[model samples]
Target: MSVARKVVIEITSDNVCPWCYIGKKRLDKAIARAPSNLSFDVRFRPFQLDPTASPYGVPKLEAYERKFGADRVEKMIPHMKAVGEAEGIKFDYGGLIANTLDSHRLLAFAASQNKQLPVSAALFAAYFENQQNIGDRETLIEIAAKAGLDADAARAYIESDAGEREVREEVAGARQRGISGVPFFRIDGLYEISGAQDPAVFEEVFAKIAESA
Candidate 1:
């Protein structure tokens, strides 16, 4: 029997990033294609693409256009749409907004419990699919429950100050590492994949790690 490989992949992302969604989808597809003997672990770290963003949410396209220039934003739309279509995901650009600090906290809590991957995926679905506010406590609890977590405990964690420091620390660490964008995937804590890349990229990385292990 093959020994289950121990691989730790970390991602620093926020809920509102369009490319982050695409990155996740691509990673999921890559993982699905990975060898069955390859067992690994994944964690979601904290990084606010816009740490200064208001809790009420800034305009999605407008914000991107302003930050990266209107021309670049205009160019990004078609690419983003294509990626979403490839992954069978709908790009709800208009519906994307929110601070995501609370979401980060919940992720940290889930990470502490070794449930970060599923919880983070569920939180993304809640925001992008269900058009729900991931920052809302009730919404987070529901999402956590859907991810196989305890809704009541998630609710309590959101209500309490628990895991806030860890979330902040993760954000600070990302900043210290010079991460300014979402969907930054760190493979085996060494190889870094940034933005919404093709599944082939993740496949290559996953294969390399599996071989190394």
Candidate 2:
């Protein structure tokens, strides 16, 4: 079949953020349900909601409560649970929240292997569902292994801060682009879609882009 056109969807998100997880799932659905002729080159960009988060990790609930207050935490949990469930994500919220620099670096390594998306998904699941610490080297290496990445190489990469500068610069760039929150989608260097929008919204935008192409 002849192609409508190709589109590059760049997603800026963090592993520890629940909304980013939901956004990723919804975007996956959108891409899967989009027009067949419009091939997609999905790029998972790096962003950290809290750049100062401890690499050693803090209890998820404690961090949320400290940052957002107990009342909001109470409300946020149910909202996340409901939204997460809709996206087929069973958010445990019992995991540790850690600095995602290493997680982002690991994703950069995965990009070279053409496994960025799966690795990103795995990182989210590791933090949000599996009660694992994404900031830890062994946990990241295990997640990397699960994503078919070379374990020794991945361990060496994450252990040494190989992509730290590049990832930090990329995160800075996202901020410089006026993005303060995550799950930001930049499509084809032309359109911008913010937040965890519905799959239908993505499909509509995709169709419009394809039509114009």
Candidate with maximal TM-score: 2
* Candidate 1 per-residue C-alpha lDDT over 1-213 given as tens digits, one digit per residue, 9 for 90 to 100: 768777777878887776787788888888889866576677777888766777666666676787889999889888877777888877666654668888888888887777888887787777766667776677788888889888888888899988777777888888898887888999877899988889999889888877777
What total of clashing residue pairs does each candidate reach? Answer: 0, 0
For lDDT, the strongest prediction is: 2
Listed in order, each prediction's TM-score against the native is 0.86, 0.97
lDDT of 2 by residue, 1-213 (tens): 575688999999888878888988998899999877688999988998999999899999999999999999999999889989899999897868889899999999999988987888888888888999999989999999998899998988888958899999999999999999989999988889999999998999898887777
Ten contiguous residues minimizing lDDT sum, candidate 1:
89-98
- List pairs with backbone clashes in candidate 2: none
- TM-score, prediction 1: 0.86
Off by over 4 Å in 2: none
In model 1, how large is the Cα lDDT of residue 200? 94
